[model samples]
Target: MASESLIKTSKYTKYTSYKKISYRSFFVGLLLFIVVSLLFIVVFNAYSGSSPRTDFHEPVNLDSTLLEVVNLKSDARLSSARVSNCTYWDCFNVYRCGRGGHDKITIYIYPLKDYRTESGTPFSQFSKEFYVILDTIRHSKYYTSNPEEACLLVPSIDTLNQHSFSKKHVSQALHSLKYWNDGENHLIFNMLPGSAPNYNSVIDLNTGKAIIAGAGFDTWSFRYGFDISIPVYSHTAEKIDSSQPDQKNYLIISTQLNIPKHYLEVLQNIASSSNDLLLLDKCKMDSDRIDYSKRCEYTTGRMFSYPDVLKEGMFCLVIRSARLTQAVLMDVLASQCIPIVIADSVVMPFNSHVDWNRISLFVPEDNVKNIVKIVHSVSKERRGELYWQLRWVYDKYFASIEKMTLTALEIINEKVFPLAARMYEDWNMPEHIYGPVNPLFLPVTAPKAPGFTAVILTYDRVDSLFTLVKKLVRTSQWHEARGATPAVHPMFTTFIMCDANRS
Candidate 1:
């Protein structure tokens, strides 16, 4: 009986030992599973949030050279104050401030030039140009001091009467000013009649000297005096050989009656006669005046809708209107057309780059007879020389429109974020940070996880889907290079979501 009891006790001891071992094993397995799950969660989150290690390929740094060239070309006359206050950034800021629902600026236009008649008829009609200027100002937020109160301040007779003007036709003259300034709630004034001009005149009110000698002087004059002036640059005419071969001729003339009627008449005659002249006009031609079918070959106008017809010509005649100054001349230069300018003021935009006398033919506005003589004198060889000179000017100052636009945007950004600008400058951030990325030039591969899974969602846009897929492929390759097992073994599976009712 004692032996049997011992056997049972031994069995019980073994069973108890077995139970304890099984419980301990189960707890150890649970703890390991929890640890592994937490570790995985951490790694997944880190991979998802972190920026991939970018391989930076060393680029050719051109900032120093570019800065040196800019400094050399820039006018030495720019004052530190002017540089700080009237920068392109400041201009952009002013534009933004003016457009941000502020008080309107009271632009007081005091004409320094005398009227054509005592009737106060303007010497030139620049209403269109003025309107465009005003419209641009209105759209920009930063220019106005108080946009709510901002308005075109015209000379009031009350202020004029205070200037000791004769009261005989005071009311009539005031009424006329009011009529002329009625559009866009703007105002204008002839400042000479009044003894004391109440408003600030853009031109020297004392000397009666018009600051801008053009049709849009009233508006532009004020803008020049108040707002920061962006130098409207253009290349000057360079001297070229007068006997060059393969010369092309372009005749540029305004067809409006506002210009002397004789100028248009002569141009019309030329258009009918000469094969070289290209007429650009906004006017609708009378069907009966010229046979369109017969003259179609010689004539190119808005009606004809020829693409870049002006650029096709080598020599362009810039007929000067009494009111128009260097505007048309600059246009001809921009078109790479050698200009025969019939106006005063040889000093225009980009005078530093171009030799005006060599490349362009400048005749005084009064000398209409010299137009034909100058045109005939320009030989084909000279035209070739001029073309090369013009091309040089264009490439140096104006070739990359995209780059210029980006530069302008940067200036605007500097104005808006002065603090950030200073910080960036201090850090020596690349000037062309937002330029094209050259994938062929990569620096180093960053460390990454072992495996990756890419899931792309797409809709109806096949092009966008295709682009996304291409980008994913590139990204996978980039990851694979960094030692990560690519999620796409054969190819990445793209899941496209499509709804029958909605795209």
Candidate 2:
């Protein structure tokens, strides 16, 4: 009160002395100040955009990271080839009070200026894979523009390809985020992470405590129940022509380059004995440097498109090249080519929810010699079944950026709110098989709508009346639900006045 009076007498009066300024003048000036403040608040809100969504029913709470990785069964481990008895949602534990179901998030993009301290940065340095990841999250149902209400956070730094930016600068960018309190509930995505000499499975950027949604994660680097194993995002995979008819002329196709000398020898020996195996090596160019976009030569001089050639083979070889997680895996899946993956340590994308046995054949790195024998063992009928199943699984879970990103979000959301999380069937089942999904779970028996009734009157028809009553008993559960479907005439009660019998 004293400060306000002093401001009104001194500052508000300007050059006028405190004695010269009248009480009316001071009151007028105060009224003008109040009006200006109100206008400022309205303008600020107008520029700030819409209010946060109120549909969320769960409360937000923070806690420690889930540490259930040690207790996981070998079958459920990320590095393990096949799916286990438990779904992805079943294996995780939330140590905190609030994390998912009601969890909402926003993406915080560092401006172009942040990319400066990183490298000789260009706007074009950001790959399409990076744009796809950002677009996928922006279009997700759980994203909120208001950061104040976000329970989780995403950073936009083109981390999809770690080689695109400097690790030190990227770490600095992470630390500069407004909500980054040791990366509590933040998510960092990396599709093609580490670079040359040592192609480490996971990127080595200082992500603090953020959840790593990355590809090429080995069992050692994977946070088991927490971190997500994503597939290498490939435009070739996304651009596969679905309209083309299915064809399988070759038994096994190996298009991978730069394999170990010993592993290459094994594949060569197998190809020598079998006419079905189509092995390809780098094409001989005039110059020493390889053009990656050019397809490898299958025959001496015959060259075909890399992934398109995969469609003609029953099984495509996913050999570990520069990295454990290969772009060829996604292309193989997209082309409906059952993957004979030889990367023994790689955690396949969404391995938690996907029953890899249905879509892929995980061959141990030591079993390179047996790959041909394994392909021959499967009958033509079984191969055809796998072909269709592989396509279904690919389109459902790993088709595009949207499916992959949403899969990660859903997994995290389920981990946080287990009670309201999606069931196993929801994650693995065919979308059409499950029919429609509704958030409201109708009770087995519900309250009746008042004044709604069914009446029946029949004379000398006790036997027929008995049958009718039995039918009604069977359908009683449906009508018991208050406001049940067929809103035209709501059902509630049943009244049967029948003939009095002496029996």
Q: Residue 205, candidate 2: how far off, in angstroms?
A: 0.7
> What's model 1's lDDT at 37?
100
- State each model's CA lDDT, in order: 0.40, 0.68
Q: What ranges in model 1 sit over 4 Å off?
A: 1-258, 272-276, 283-302, 345-347, 350-354, 395-503
| 10 residues in a row with least lDDT, candidate 1 | 67-76
Residue 354 lDDT in model 2? 72
- For model 2, residues 412-493, the per-residue Cα lDDT tens digits are 6766656657665566556654356554886455322223356899997756776676567566343545543332333348
Off by over 4 Å in 2: 1-115, 118-125, 243-247, 288-301, 431-503
TM values, all candidates:
0.31, 0.64
RMSD of each: 28.1, 17.9
